[model samples]
Target: MREKAQESVKAVLPVMVIVLILSFLIAPLSPDIMVEFMTGAVLVIIGMAFFSLGAEVSMTPMGERVGGNLVKTKKLWFIIGTGFVLGMMITISEPDLQVLARQVPSVPNMVLILSVALGVGLFLAIALIRILVGFALAPLLILFYLLIFLLAMLAPADFLAVAFDSGGVTTGPMTVPFIMALGVGISAIRNDRHAEDDSFGLVALCSIGPILAVLILSLVYQTEGSFSPEIGRNIATSVEVGQLFFEATPDYMKEIAVSLLPITVFFGLFQMFSLKLEKKTLSKILIGLVYTYIGLVLFLTGANVGFIPAGNALGTVLAALPYSWILIPLGMLIGYFIVKAEPAVYVLMKQVEELTDGAISGKAMQISLSIGVAVSVGLSMIRVLTGISVLWFLIPGYVIALGLTFLVPKIFTAIAFDSGGVASGPMTATFLLPLAQGACIAMGGDVVRDAFGVVAMVAMTPLITIQILGVLYVRRETQSADRSTGVEYQVDISELFAEYEDDEIIEF
Candidate 1:
């Protein structure tokens, strides 16, 4: 319990400080606004504690256990079918996906949501199959990404930007911890010693499935719209922060409850028939679910109320300045700090460092993620400043990443992909996106074309940064090999005789 509190403080306290600093920088906050922001910050801290506790209690363990049990099936198709259905269902429940769906113009919300979910479902199934079959991660990535890029070339021009962004936002906080835990669980089922190494990348590859699926959807819709950036989101003054929380509270709580319902029902049915979970265990998990629900509500409310408006206001004020080029460096600074505050990232980086026995340290991973997200933020702000095609950056970026897939270590290939999804946390959507949107508005650009892909850019750079780490590791290995080759192998017979004489060798 103390641990969870410390974690929450470490995560939420920094953001609260950032908020206070921003409030001061803006027009001197009225007294009411000051109190409201403070209250919202408190709520956010409370929410992070609940959400983190709930995830540990319910989400991660449940997914891991279920994943282990589900993949025990001898029948391959059954596992695939389960993966497909679960992926689709989870995406349908993802708040971030719903948020992205609403922003997609002309497409019916349900239709687009369903399509994106289906894309996730189909790819998730394939990802599971890859794990089970024990395919090399590198080659598989090359093949699938090659197809994705090829499809992008032929895909509708208007839909290109949207296609890539789907890959980013679909794997937000709600989906990452559970899905990554599930991968760990499922991979543990493998008898191979390398199974632990293989467990790291399921979310990574699963993220791709959406990109490919969306590009296909794009083929059906013509999206050749003019490109411009704009941002318009409700900004809360200190007085209005509490009001924002109240307004956002009910919807997120209801949505989160509904999201968990199907999975719980499925677990209940499975337990009744097959697993029969012990009373104590069942009770604990149920309690954890409650924690998750409470946590998500608070987290969402705080993010919408305190985080989003503050970020947008700051971005708008900065972008409107004559020295708007400051947006890039400012974005990099914000990106560096923003990642540390994302709750799920702590879970992931800790797990990786532990699982690898320091082969990959959390500090190193943190540094890589910081650099990646920083570059992404800079790129995103540039898009806000000038309405460049998202493809102009995305295609080249993905190509370089995919190219690195072949050159880097297998584990890194997986980690890189997962990092993309992991990087697009709640902060990205609730705060950073709004910031870009606000900047776009300040610049009078089209919001959908320009601001929409910030999440995509956030998701892209990690794929490269982590892979570069992998490349470095491989180079060190090569250097070590070459150095070892220079050493001569010789028998020190006289020294052996002297050592043997002193030891009085027993075996002889």
Candidate 2:
């Protein structure tokens, strides 16, 4: 417990410091803005920590055990069907989809929500097959991405960013842990050394499904009745922590709980068929469920109360200022720290490092994420400045990244794309969206079209950077090969023995 708490603190500290610096040294915010953001940051911390605890308690064990059980079967349809259902069910429970759905201007929230969920479910099935067939991750990625680029060229320009953004938002705090563990458990049952290599690519592939689905959605959204969102209102009450907690806490808790129920229902179905969970295992998971519940509730309350509004207000103030160029640099600084705050990132980085025994360091992944996010933000600000179609950037960018997939190490290509989705989690939704929204309002631009693509950009860049790192690693390895063999020849044992052999006994 103490160790977990320390981990949570380490994760939260980066965000806390960023927030503090932004509030004081940057555009000084109103007291209300400060209060609201602090509250929101607190909620994010609690949400992440508790959500993590809960996954350990319930989601991981259940997903692993269920996956392991199912994989033992020889029936092919059973594996695909189970994975599909599980993916769809988990994606529905994700709060990030809801958050993005609210931003979308066309179609009912439920329509977009269900659409994205279905897409994830379908692709997860495909990913499982890829793993089972021992397929090359590179060629499939290349082929599918070529199709995506073709679709992008034919599709409406507006659909481009939204499509890519759908992929990232689906892989939020709620969806990541369970889905990853399920992939691992299922892969582990195969008894192949390559299982570890195959344990990944689930995230990378699942991300693409949504982009394609939402591209279809964009067509529907173009014709369907427009859905306008009224920004959520907080009644002007005396701002007290106690009062805010009582009112907003229940609301967000209910929202998160409702979203989470489908996963439990799925779990219940698994339980009905003799899941074979030890009693102690079940008890611990139940405890984790409780912790997750409390943590998410607090997390939502704080973020909504403090962070979202403060973020918006900060953007508003910064954009209105004479030195609005500060937006890019300021966003870069925050982006550098922001990805660190994501609890799931730690899980991903640690797992990769451990699997490869530091051949793939978390430090490298972290640096890549930070640099990618910074660049994405700079580009997003440019989008707001000029009303360019999202395609102008996203289409070519993905083409380059997918093109690199064929050239880089297989794992590097997979992990890089997966990180793209994982990096654009709740903080982007709550804080960065508000930041961009605030700036848009200041710039007199269409907030829906201009400000919204920051998350998309944030998600897109990591695919390129991480893959580039992979290319570097590959080059370095190639260059080192000749020198390594030369060293081997120079150090031959025949020369070493000259000093110590029988003749040497007399000469020495």
**All-Cα superposition RMSD per candidate:** 4.5, 3.2
What is candidate 2's local distance difference test score? 0.75
Residue 186, candidate 1: C-alpha displacement in angstroms:
2.0
User: What is the TM-score of candidate 2?
Assistant: 0.90
Residues 1-508 of candidate 2 have per-residue lDDT tens digits of: 5665666667667767776776788677766555556666766776767766776667667666766777777678999998798788878877777766765656688888788889899989998888777787777777777777677676665566667778888887666766776777787877777777777788888988888887777765673222232232443544564476577777787877876787677777777775856778777877877776776677667766666777687777788888787788777777777777776676678667866789888898989888888888877776766766666777778888888988887788878878888888777767777788788788887776677777788888999999998998889888899889888988895587766879766675
lDDT for each residue of candidate 1 in 1-508, tens digit (9 for 90 to 100): 5676777777666656765675577423334434544565677667778777888878788878877887876778888998899899888888877766655566667878888888888878877787787877777777887898899889765667677778877886666777888888789889897688688777777778778877776777655444322222334464354455677788888988877786787677767866778999989989988987887778777776665655666677778888888788778877877776676777788778877998888888888998999899999999889889788888789889988977877788888888888888887877788778778888888776787788889888999999999888889889988777655223344455565654576554
**Residue 91 miss distance in model 2 (angstroms):** 2.4
The candidate that achieves the highest lDDT relative to the unseen native structure: 1
Which structure among the candidates has the greatest TM-score?
2
* Candidate 1 lDDT: 0.77
TM-score (all chains, Cα) for each model: 0.88, 0.90
